[model samples]
Target chain A: MPKETVSLRQAACTFVMFLFGSSVIMGVNSEAGQDSWISLLLAMLMALPIILIYARIMRLYPEMDLFEIVEKVIGKIGGKIVTILMIWYALHLCALVIRDFSEFIKVTVLTETPQLNIMLILILVVVYMSKSGIETMGKWSVIILPVITLVVIFTMILGLERIDPTNLLPIMGHSLGTIAGGAYKIFAFPFAETVVFLCLAGSLRKKDSPYKLFTVATLIATVIFLLVIMRNLLLLGPAVTNAKYYPSYTAVRIINVGDFLVRIEGSTALNFILAGVIKTTVCLVAASKGITRLFGLCNYKHIVFPLGLLAVALGTLLYENIKEAFDFLEIYQIYAIPFQIIIPVFIWILAEIKVRQDKAANGSHSPDSAQTDAAG
Target chain B: MNKKGKCFIIVLLMLFLLCGCQGYRGLDEMVIVTGIAIDKTPENDNYRLTFEIVDLTVPVKEMGLKGQVIESEGKTLFDAVRNAKKRITKKLYFGQAQIIIVSQEIARNEDVGIIIDWFLRDVECRETMCFIISQEETAREMFEIEALTHPLVSTEINNILELDQEVTSTTLCVELYKAFGGLHSEGEELALPVIHKAINNGKTVGETNGMAVFKDNKLVGFLPPNESKYYLFAIDEVKGGILTLSAFGEEHNISLEIFENKTGASFDYKDGKVKVTVKTDTTVYLGEVMRPYAPMDEKEINELEDIAKSELKKNISNSIKKVQSEFGADIYGFGNMIYKKDIKLWKQLAENWEEHFRTLEVEVESEIEIANTASLK
Candidate 1:
């Protein structure tokens, strides 16, 4: 089968939506209270180096995906072992996102509707999307990102009249340690979770710079993140924002524009579903590719359905209730450290060493050595 | 068709047929709950829950669109809510519920935070629903009284409280989330609107009588309608209201319409004495010059401003003193203001805030600006 490719713009759009999928609903650094936005800004800065490492790894082997690159850099046996771990991480992350969406729907809107049914329908859409391949996901992201952005912007404007500027006072109310802790919590879940995109980075069109795409996507996601946190803080006040489970939804519920446009918080559910579908679909596609490469399969499409079913089952087993689901988030930040930070940095260091050695062997000190190396 | 296409079509058909609209309910199958009232029953010590369900058959233009009020008693709120199913055929839907009326009994005995937890936890409940405390013996009595303007008593009360921001600051529009916030915050208090059945123009009607103040979870005291406006002004929540200034010589009742307000609170602690300064900036329009409108010169305008300013200061100080001395409750949120200004100071004061508030010296400063005089001038 021929390889699929997508434009850097589409990649950036998909990346932003992916980061926004769960973070927008879960809220960022709520422990910081009124200073949550400050923590978000710090988290973005903390995430930059990790994102750059992922981008550097992608540039080292232009055509090879994460699975192929792992196999090439490490030996065949070690590569297969690493490929299995990557597949498990992708599948686990996908299920967690699915669980977050399903649990949120169950708690907020669909009380009588069974969570399993919600997960099933969502996974069905994800399966169909992943089967269409990476290029279609890119195009889907570009089309949906603007509409989602417009809805969020419109909601924020409508909520402006209700916000109290004094709620944002006492800017650095929290100590530096508390703020840093809050940044670490947010960094692992949304920002560092961008490591999954390394598998799909190989699918970007040949001329696009992965660094530019990743940076642009992170910046867009960070701005949206700031707006969402600020809206919650201003409209709900610090006391209420920290109390509610979904502060954005609760804040938007109070938007009374002449009382006719009240109860528009349902738009929050729309934002969640759109971004969640993109994020889950990307995870499934990346996992399927890893599984296919591990087993020497010719095509990844055949594995998408089975892996998606596994994701549904895993989501159901992730937690018993919403409280437990949230309890898992703190543990998730710690658990994701190995996959998101440690492994990627290790791989980037190895790739840099390999690139320099190749340049040394060829006696070529040109800046275009990576391109020549890829051609070889 | 290809096998994949055929499978896709079959699965789609199965989804539509098998799922059967998971969370959807037909209009006839569900009854819309317009308002809810909770009171403790005398006999069983259980909760007496009254649901004001909207009767859809009545025309919108009808004079008395009598809604059905279902009553049930149970050990818990959800139990009582579910027990109502025995009386009504359809499930009670709360998405349209506009008001939650807590009786004086519940406000006195039960925690307001606990009473509102069921509403906040329910998926069908909107966070914007207004929370009110009924002045009558039982909240059900308030619902039983016929509404003067609207068919549903809750609707009439909701409209009146919404308009109360402009007419008077007597009734506070406390949303569900805001009430929860007040209950959850340390050293903060919840002030809710009080609804009562009153005789208005020879007919009984639902009236927003005054304000109910809660120190923690239980009702601490009541603020009369006259003083509630001052409380709102002290909090900078005076959207629009009328202030009758009579401090001038010979009791000249000049009605000033409040158009704008800005409140600033500061605290000073010296040797265990706390001094709280509340500064208020009020911009008003000359609504009425009862003494036969005279062409006001600059000197007269300044005199009017002075009278208005002193009156505002007096009203605010009286209200603060009433809440502090009578109730020993810091509903003015002086502690919360200190928390915002200086967290460390607040940390030390939060433990004995109520006691500290009682003896704390309060200073009121009002800057009144008559922004506009009526066209009659």
Candidate 2:
């Protein structure tokens, strides 16, 4: 089969959708009260350097995914150890997002539907998308991103009348410590979670600049996050925004224009499901690649079904109820650190050192000299 | 079979699974509730809920739809709501409910936060529904009164409250979300419209007049309809209302219809005391003149404007004083204004804000412009 590659625009769109996956429904960290927007802005600033490092790692290993790069950079045995960890991270992240989406659907729209049913239906779609390969997923992202963006912009415009600007007053009322803590939560969950893109970066065309893709996508997602946070805060006020489980849905429920444009939250629910599909599919594909590389399988697509089923099972058994699902979010921020921060940063440093050494050795030899880089 | 044919069959099967047949309910299987009224049972502390369900049996050819009231009792609001299943054959769907009426007894005695928890937490209940406190003996009585304008008393009350924006600004329309916000916020209080039975043209009807003010989650006092308008003026919510002035004499009154109004409340803190200055700018058109003649010179119009401004200033000040001395609730968001102005001062005054509000000095200033006399003048 021909190698699958996605254009730079499709990659960026996928990145944006992935960032919006669970964050849109869960909303930003409300511990900062009315200052949640400030927390989001701070999170964006902190995420910039880390995402740049991710882009740098992908650029160093031009056509190799994270799992392949790990084996090459570190010896095979150590690389296998890291690969297992990455596989767990990818699979767990996939299950977490699936659980978030299913819980939202159960709590909001389909109250009587069992969560297992929701997860099964969602995982089936995700597995199909994963089996279709990265090119198809990219194209799907390109088509769905605009619909999600339009829904968000439309809701914001209609919600303007209900928003009370005064709700944003008393800015920075919370202590700096509290605001920083909120910003850290925002950074760990949504922003740093974009590190999953490295697993699929190998599918980008040779001409596509990973740096530009990650930067532009992160910036766009940050702006959307700010608008959504401010909209929720203004529409529901700080107190209600903090108290509700899903602030965005509750905020959009209040948008009644001339009483004719009511119940537009259905559109919001659709956006959540669509974005969630892209997110879960990315995680499933990444995990499938990890498993194939670990076990020496001929193709990753062979295991996408079994892996997706595993994710569905994990998602179903992860939480007891909606409250437990939300309570897991706090632990998730801390739990995500090793996969999102440490391992990526470590791999990026090793790749940079190896690249500079390879350049030095090549510079010392003639143009016709034999290539000694076994990883290449 | 070819791959394409097999793939098509699989896709068709998946489509059937995705329809979510488990939670599906046909429209005919459920009865839509337009409004709900909650009152305490006469015998015990259990909740008695009255649901005004839309009567689906009414033919579309009829001018207006009819409503059927279903009453249930239980230990809690949700229990009472679920107990309603014993009375009605179809399931009670609350997604379209437009209003929730709480008896004055419930608002005065119970912690409103507890009463509304089910409405806010329940996924089926909408947060946009308007909340009104029924001044009648029981909230269910408000639903039993005659529905003159609409077949359902709930619909009638919802229409009257909506029309209040254009006709009379005497009543406050507080949605469930807004009440929740007020209950949770430290610097603000909740105020909802008061509904009661009234005689209109020899027929009984529900009327929304005045507002029920709450200190925290419990109702503390009531503002009369006339004073409610002034309360709206103080809070800058007076969209359209009549301002009558007897400048010529007690018998000859001039009524000015408000066209546009803007009220700005500023705070001045000195020596630990907070002073609020409410400035109102209004434009009005001469609506009616009870005098014998309709003609009025420019000088007379200017004098009339001055009289209207002073009267407005006096009424607004009086209403603020009434709320301050009687309820001591910061329904006007004076505390919120200070909090927004200076966080440090607000933090210091946050505790015991109601006590501070009771003694807070307020000054009222008004500027009125008589745009033009009506076609009569």
Clashing residue pairs in candidate 2 are none
After superposition, which runs of candidate 1 have C-alpha atoms over 4 Å from their true positions? A27-29, A365-376, B1-15, B18-20, B57-64, B247-249, B269-273, B292-298
Report the number of the highest-DockQ candidate: 2
Q: How is the predicted docking of candidate 2 categorized under the CAPRI scheme?
A: medium
Candidate RMSDs in Å, in order, are 2.7, 2.5
Quick one: best TM-score, which candidate? 2
Pairs that collide, model 1: none
What docking grade does candidate 1 earn?
medium
Interface RMSD of 2: 1.0
Q: Could you list the chain B TM-scores for each candidate?
A: 0.93, 0.96
Model 1 agreement with the true structure over A1-376: per-residue lDDT tens digits: 8989998888999999999998789948468988998999999999998998898788787756898888777769988887888899999999999999999988888888999989999998999999999999999999999888887889899999888786876678889898888898889989999899988877986677788988989999999988888888888888778767888888888898997998888898899999999999989998999999988899999999999999999999999889998888879989999899988887877777877786788776655565735643
